[model samples]
Each structure stands twice: as structure tokens, then as C-alpha cells.
Target: MLRTLWKHVAADLTLAAPLLRLHFHDCFVRGCDASVLLDSTANNTAEKDSPPDLTLGGFNVIDEIKTELEKACPGVVSCADIVALAARDSVSFQYKRLLWKVLLGRRDGTISRASEVIANLPPPYFNFTQLKQSFSSKGLTVHDLVVLSGAHTIGNSHCPSFDNRLYNFTGKGDQDPSLSPPYAAYLKTQCKSLSDDTTQLEMDPGSSLSFDNHYYKLLLQHEGLFESDAALLTHKTSLNEVKKMLISRNFFAEFGQSMRRMGNVQVLTGTEGEIRKKCSVVN
Candidate 1:
């Protein structure tokens, strides 16, 4: 019945679209630990990898929902479990469909660092080799790499996150000619204003809140926003697999399975971690 309770909690949390989007952004960048949601502390500033103060607007929404759940179910549920369940459910609800199973019993991680965020999360401009290496360090495979990239379907990137991809098209240094002309034009327009608000670039223009196969379709159309995303179509090891997934339903099904595997990687459980009272600022 834990799985059923988990699903109900997830569905309830999905009512907040903003939190759902933030969850996707965090998980896609650094697995599904909610570490990206942690705030910075003076003590952790000197750490090797400190996470940014992204100002998770949805955090309060999550807390409110969790409080309600606790009163209804007592201590039967955990905050960490709620975060994970909500994340998966948000994707499914936003897309209007369900795909994979999310295992429960994951404990919240007590430690969060900014330097680690910089080192672990893939930059928007990384090449296929760099992407493969980054995921490999986390013990994920090529298939996991492509499937997780699908998370881009729901989140948005700031101009600072993807500005280099535009105005710099050199195949060698910063420009990636693999980005389609229409796609590049869209990014240029999106980032034209120098305001921080201008950095808001949607991953899937077709369906921003959905989690279907739109990401694969975007890659096929050469409309992927990031250099790393476009690189999938040009890289030898990943190109064919990406193409196959885009055109075949069976391939998309396997891609979903791969995502379930990626989500469950090396998670801390039992008494291994702590649930922070604040997701942004670490305790």
C-alpha cells in the first residue's frame, strides 16, 4: 500500500505546476536527489562543489502539501519520498500519461554542495564525449544518457545557460553547426534581451508542460536548444540510437524504461541521509 500512498501523494503535489517544473529541472541536471533545490550556507561556500541558490519557488508549495499529508497520514510518509513521488507524478500528470515505476523508501540527503553542482551537472555546450563521460561517472550508460535528456521536455534554461550556443557557431570552439537554422533563430530571439528574465528558454516549444516524446521529435527536427542536446544527432555512438528512438514507438518505450533505471541510481536510503527542513538552504 506504500506504492499506492506514494502515487496519491504524487498526484496531489502535481497540482502545482511550478514545483513540478522545478523538480524536472533539478533531476535532469543532477539526478533526482533534490540537491539542486538546496540553498547555500556560509560554511558550504568553501566546499569543492556548492549548489546555486536557484530560489525554488515551488518549495513552499511542496511544504504546504507535505504538511497536509502528514496530518492526514501521520509519520507514515517521508518528505524525501514525497519529493521523489511528486517529481515522477508531475511529469506524468503534465504529459497526461504514466510510464514508469518510482521506488520508495529513499531518505533525504543531508549534504549539498555548490562545487559538486558545477562539476557534476553537464554544461549546455558539452559535446557527446563529455556527456557520456559525465553520466558514466555516475554509473549510467549511453541509453540512460539519451533517456534522461528527455527531461528537457518540461524545463526552461536561462540565457546564461545557453547563450554560447547562439552567436557562436564554430564547430571547433563554441559554435555547433548541428543546431538547425530555425532552432538557432529561436534561441537568438529568446536571448536577445540582456535581462535575466530573457534567459527563459523553453525546452519543448510544442508542449512545454508535457513529458511525452516531444523532446525526441525536437532533436529530430534539429530544434534542440542546447549544444549537448544537438550533439546527440551528430555523435557516432549516440546519433543512430537517437534517430531510431525518434522514429520508432518501441524505441521510445525502451527510452522510458532507461529513465526509470537512471532515476533509481545510487540513492541514499534508510538512515543514510537526512530530510532538510528547507530545500534551498541546507541545514
Candidate 2:
């Protein structure tokens, strides 16, 4: 019942969607214990001395909604649980279809550090081997890696995230020469210049808002925008699994299952972490 209500509250705060997803991704990949959110600061470190973009972009919106939740439910609801609920609910809100069963009662971590973000988050230029290692480090299989990458289906990547792909890819940076001619041509147009905006690159061209097997379909057609995405197609084990899911109704089913599993990943629960008065800064 609490989880259900939190879902609605999260939807009322639209932009909280992605922030919530990221929180769960971090927890699931590591543990719900918030260790992943910790950063390394050798000496005295203040928030100002930390990374400027410390909070996830939409975290302010999430913080507002969380404040409302606190008022209504007081200490009953945990911020980590809210993060998980918001992630699943956000996807449902976007797709208008139920995908995952989210577990609740995850407590918030007291610690959050910028260095952790730099260490855990996968780099854009990461190849298949590096990605596999990263996922493995988190106890996830290659299949989980592929499915989670599908989150790109609903989110937008900034130009900085993919700039190296556009300007530095050996065969073709922005437009890979190996990609289908038409698709390559389209990407060339999309990423014409370094200064060109990348938020416009829709993961699924026709229906950017919907979550489906389109990302997999894109990989099949060689339209994957990032090297990490495109690499899924190169490995037979991972590629075949992704292909099977793309063709079957099981794609949605498995995606939801994977998402639920992701939500349960190493989260800081109980008294391990604090519920930040502000999602961006520790209280």
C-alpha cells in the first residue's frame, strides 16, 4: 500500500523519473547500502569543492516530491525505497504499461560522494570487454548488462557522453562506416558538428517516449549510437539473447524482471544511510 502511494507521488513529480532510475541502478549494481554513493576525498572536502553537477539533473524535482511524501507519511517511507519505486513508476508512466514489481522499505544512505559517481558509472567510450568487467564486478551477467542498457530507450544522453564516439571512433566516430548507409547518413546529420546538441538524439527514432524492444531492434540494424550499445551485437552469447528478447513478447517480461532485480541491487537499508534533507546534499 505504501509502495503504491509512493508510485503515484513520484509520477506527480515528472522529472524525478530518471533520477530515481539512476539511484536504483547504483544500488542494484552495488548494494542497497549506499557504498556506491560514497566518494573519495583525501582531505577536507566541502560540497562546493566537489563536482559542480553533483546531483542528478532531476534530483531537485525529486526532492520536492520527497518532501511532500515526508509530510504525508512522515518517517514511514524510506528515500531509497522511494528511489526504487520512482524508477519503476516512471517507466510505467512513460510507456503506459506495467513492467516491474518493485520492493519497498529501502533506507537512504547517509553518505554520497562525487568520486563514487566517477568510479562506478560506465564511461561512454567503454568497449564490450570493459563493460562486461564492470557488470561482472557488480555480479550481473552479460544478459543483465544488455537489458539494463535498454534503459537508454527512455532517457536522453548528453553530447558530452557521446562526443568521443562522434569525434574519435576509429572507423567512424559520429557516423560509423560499418553501420548501414542510411543509418550512418542519418547519424551524420544528427551529429553534424561538435557543438551540435545531442539531447535531440532519440533512442527510438519514431516513438521516443515509449519503452520497447526498439533498442534491440536498433542494434540489429546497426543504429546503436554508442560503442557500448553497438558492442552488444558483436558477442554471440549476449547478442543472441538480446535478439531473442527483441523478437519475443518475453522482452517486456524479462525487462521488468531485470528491472526489479536491478532495484534490489546493493541498496543502503536500515540505519546504514541517512535520508538526505536534500537529495543533492547530505544533511
Candidate 3:
């Protein structure tokens, strides 16, 4: 089913990381109830409108898939399940293999307030200790933090996310001491205009589109695009996990495990929540 749906998507090369991120944002706030897909109403703003979630993609793809599923099976499927499936399918597209199997039966929540986004979704500038606390708030472990950071192996970022690293790391107008010198210079050229929201910087340099261990490899060189990525090296636990994945061929297995754990965050099942007719609005 996913293979057939993949053929119709426009940006085939991308979408994996965004779908995964959408799920992350959804789960972190109010559980994975498809709340991230809610559209803003006149009375209130939606989570999608929040600053941290502003760059989130794959909404249209999920909506299209929901429309098709509703036509085929009525109310049998949930938007939350569709997103989880889409995330797994998107990753499989790049890996050319299955990474994880998603569990269904998740329901959609009707609430989406933009005000709740930033508090739940931490910024890229977060340091190691901060990132650790952020993940811990969601019931994710230090190991999960390092493993899921591997998703940076794919996807691009808006220039503002890490421009401070390239232009002004310290108040003295110097680049971040933690970032690689040559890589920082390269980023300066790529992000000449710090305010350019249209410009994108690849999270993973050579293998940005591939779901591999390249993210860990780059962090070892201090070429990570965000302070959060570099933070993995600051602590003993996260650093060991990074090095473990770097040398072990079973990174895929560990990633799958961590993702499954992450996906289960505050989930609503059984009699909780409602199944929406459309992903963009409440029924």
C-alpha cells in the first residue's frame, strides 16, 4: 500500500524526516492524536502555526492518504495511524528496506493551540543538558535522545536554525568553538543572509537524503548543524551511545527500538479521542 502511495507523492526524495518530525511534535504535546494536522480557526491558532512547528512538512501527503483511506474503509483508519505508517514508509523509501512496523488504532484529538508548540518542541540551539531534559519530559531516555538524533541523517533545515553558529556564536561575533572551522566557513557561504528563511541547510552533509549512520560520523568531526546535535558528545551516556552506533552495524535495530518507544508517548487508544473525517479539522 505504501509503495503504491509513494509513486504519487511530489517530493519523493524528501519527506521521511518531516513525517517523523510531525509524529514527534504530535506525541510530545498531547500524545500522538493527529493534533499537529489541525488547522487554525478564527477563535484559536493551531499547533502547525507555532514557530517550532512552522517548518513541518508532509501534511498534504498525510491528508491525501487519509482521504483515500476514508473512501476505501470509512472510519476504520485513524489520522494518527496514517502518520505513523507514513513515517515508517518514508524511511523505507530511502533505506530501500523496512525499518519498523507501526501499530494502528490511534485516535485523533480535536485540540490544536499554537501557544503549546514551543514549550513542547525544543529549539535546535539547545545544548546537551537541555536536550536531555526536553526528551526526559516526554519519557524518552538519554539513549533514545542520541538514537533518534540519527534522524538528522536525512532532511534540510531553515537557515535561521543554525545561523548563529555561522555568523555569531558568542556575543563577541565569533563562530561557535565547538563547530568545525572549515565547516563553519562553508555554512557562512551557504547562509550569507542570516534572515533568509527560504534558504535551506542540509543536516547531514554528504548523505542528507540517506538513512544511515553518517549523522553520528559527522558529529564526531563537530560538523553537526545544530547545538543539540553537538550536545550528544558533552555527556558520558549520550557520547557512548553515539560511539556505539558509529561502530556497530546494528544501529538500524537500535533506531527501530528507540522510535517505537518514542511513538508510544502519551498515546490515546480504546475509548479515548475521536476519528476525524479530515486530517485538517475536527469533526
Which candidate's TM-score is highest?
3
How much lDDT does each candidate structure score?
0.62, 0.62, 0.85
**Which number leads on lDDT?**
3
**lDDT value for candidate 1?**
0.62
Clashing pairs for predicted structure model 3, backbone only? none
Sort every candidate by TM-score, greatest first.
Answer: 3, 2, 1
Candidate 3: regions farther than 4 A off? 9-11
Ten residues in sequence with the least summed lDDT for candidate 1: 46-55
Q: Estimate each model's TM-score.
A: 0.77, 0.80, 0.96
Off by over 4 Å in 2: 1-21, 28-55, 94-97, 171-175, 197-199
Tens-digit lDDT track of model 3 for 1-283: 5854466433577777788788888888887889999999999999998889888998888988888889889887889888888888888885566788777778888888888888888789998888989999989999999998998998899899988887778766778999999999899888986677788978997787788898998999999999899889888989999999896466788888888887788788887888889999888
Error of 2 at 65 (Å): 2.3
Per-residue lDDT for 48-166 in model 2, tens only? 13442343444444556668787777766665666666566666665554467877767666555554554666665677888888877766778888887776666555555554555
Worst 10 residues of 2 by lDDT: 46-55
- Model 1 Cα lDDT, one tens digit per residue, 1-283: 2344345436553233455445444544445566655655666642123333352345655566556775677654555556665665555653445655767665556555565656666777788889899888777788777876776776566676666666555643354567787777767766873344445767788576555567888888888888888878767768767766665565547756775565565666666666555445444
